[model samples]
Target: MLSIAITGANSGIGLRAAQALATAGHHVLALCRDPDRGRAALADINAHATHPAGLIEADLSIPDSIKAAADQITHTVGHLDVLINNAAVFDQTVREPRFTADGHELFWATNHLGPFLLTAHLSPLLAAADRPRVINVASKGLLSMPRIRIRFDQLDDPSWYTPTRAYYHAKLAQVMTTLSLAEKAEGHLETTCVRVPAVRLDPDRVAAMPRLLRTLYAPKNRMAVPAERLGETYARLATRAGSLPGPYVDENLRPVRAPASAYDRAARERLWSLSQTATGDPAWAW
Candidate 1:
């Protein structure tokens, strides 16, 4: 069975994916920011899993935490067949920008740079496996903001920061990174970016929302895709044999084109260079 690591596996899509993968008899590693939540998630996953799931406390927004988590994974699993960069912060309530300890915007750091560094740190472990694969997540919400572009110079600037803007911007970077990795690691490893559609939240979470939002979101929530469906999609991509349809795919595992910006080789290269610098230039196995 493949050894798979999924960030943000404590809840929502991540937790569901962990449950599905573990039930499939794969060794699933649930990487979460909170230890308590991780333990609870592990227990739940193990209850139905033939193979007990593992937990590694990891706060992706924090560079030190990501490093420590990678080290822990090395000791626990030795090698990883798949790494799913799924942890992301997208709080819609926050109207102001927040900064990480590293002086980067919270969304930019957590959603983009965090995954970049984590992948770099785990490159060796991934390369050691027989068929290494990396799955990056993007949002189908990007289709709504077709004009959105990566503000390279103002990525961390608070001037024009908005929750939705920051989120999609970072997601766009992730999509570009996936394509770049696929090209750079052509014969060495496999990489793909999944364009996630609007996923329905747990009923409890929706009930916890403010009354106005709860009312407004009810209709949309009904139309949102089920978390379990997307979770299985993630499991499939992690274990499916043969090459992927393309670097970018939809929830159905069908190939889909990325944003036009993702195709600009020069911009992607620039983002790569910036990401390396932001991440302290970890040794890339490719």
Candidate 2:
């Protein structure tokens, strides 16, 4: 069985993917931040899993939690066939910016910096796999923002924050990070970013949202695919035979180029450098 680890596996696409992968007989590490929710998800997955699944609790918004989880995975699993950096926060309905425990902006910390550090620390375990893959879940929403780049200076400044704008920038950062990893790992890793389409949320949850948010997200939901469908796509990418290099792939698994800014070599390197400092791991090469 392929040993795989998926972050944010407690709900939405991440949970669906974990269940699907487990039912397909892979040994999955369902990484989640909440203990109660994680155990519930574990029970749900184990119910039908061909191979038993396990859980790892770590809040991706905190660097220490991410580091500890990586260590746990290394000690427990030893080797990994796939690492899916699938956790993300989209505060589309929030009026103010939320900060992580480290005081970094919530969206940037959870969506970009945390995943970058987790993947870097776990590189050795991934290398042990005969043909390991790293799948980063990006967004098609990023394609619409042609002018927005990583605003390194204003990441923590909430005065100008808009939920969608913050989410867009964070997702773009993830795309660029995927490119950076693809370049640095070259022969050692096959990394790819998947542009997951918008997904329809549970009806009750959608109903609980504010009217403005409900209206704003409804159009996207109408076009949104089921979370499980996207989950299946993630599974295919993990175990697929051929290499899918780090070009961003659409929901259909066709390569789609991100905005030109994401491909800027200098910008990518700059982001990588800033990310090392932001994550507080100066010794992390590449």
Candidate 3:
């Protein structure tokens, strides 16, 4: 069984994928910001769990919280085989441009920078493992985002997208940043992102709701895929042989280029440097 760890594992796609991994005889470690909520989410999965999993407390909105989570996973767990960068934030309530306690733009922190720091800190453990894999949960919604120039003057505002552009840009940053880190880490680890096609599990949840709704309470698309399906794609990436590496995967689990901006190396490096500052971590040595 694979020793796998996943963030945002308490709900939505992350939860389902963690459940799937546990159900497949793997030792699953689910990272949640709050243990109370984490336990509630885990009960459903554990009830049907073929292998019980552990939960680690973390809040990606704050870098230190993620760092603390990393410490427990590394020191307490012995080793980590797979790390899924799955937690993300999107909601109409936070449309006004909020900041984490760390003062980072909420979307940027949760969607991109937080994962960057967490992945950065866990490098040694991941590299020491027999075979290490990092799966980042991105969204094909990146296709809908504006072209990210990634200039020194611009990154402070992931706000260019307007109503929801901030959130989508954060996703776009996740893709670009993942690609960049894969190259930077080169021989050390394998990093990949699964671009979510579309999903519809519990659409009324705050995180799942979009900015504009035609009706007060109507679920938009029943035809839209479910979180289980999203988890399937994530699980396939976690367990599959190098079928899709360092690229975005569609619903079919095939490679697809989300946006031209997603491939910018210079932009990636810049984001890396900035993320280093945001996370208050040392620059990458390897």
- Alpha-carbon RMSD, each predicted model: 1.0, 1.8, 2.6
Of candidates 3 and 1, the better by lDDT: 1
Candidate 1 clash total?
A: 0
Candidate 1 residues lying further than 4 Å off, grouped into runs, are none
Ranked candidates (TM-score, high to low): 1, 2, 3
What digit string (tens of lDDT, one per residue) describes model 1 on residues 1-286? 9999999998888999999999999999899998997898899899999899889999989999999999999898878899999989887877899998889999999999999999999999999999999999999998987777779888789999999899999999999999999888877889999999999987877987889888999999999999999999999999998886679999999999898899999999999999999888888888
**lDDT for predicted candidate 3 compared with the true structure:** 0.76
TM-score of 1: 0.98
**Which rank order by lDDT, best down to worst?**
1, 2, 3
Please provide TM-scores, in order, for all candidate models, with all chains considered together.
0.98, 0.94, 0.90
Q: What is the C-alpha lDDT of each candidate?
A: 0.92, 0.85, 0.76
Number of the top lDDT candidate:
1
Q: Candidate 2 on 105-178: residue-level lDDT in tens?
A: 88888888889889888888898888888899888777677787888778788987888877888889888988
Cα error, candidate 2, residue 16 (Å):
1.3
Model 2 residue runs over 4 Å out of place are 282-286
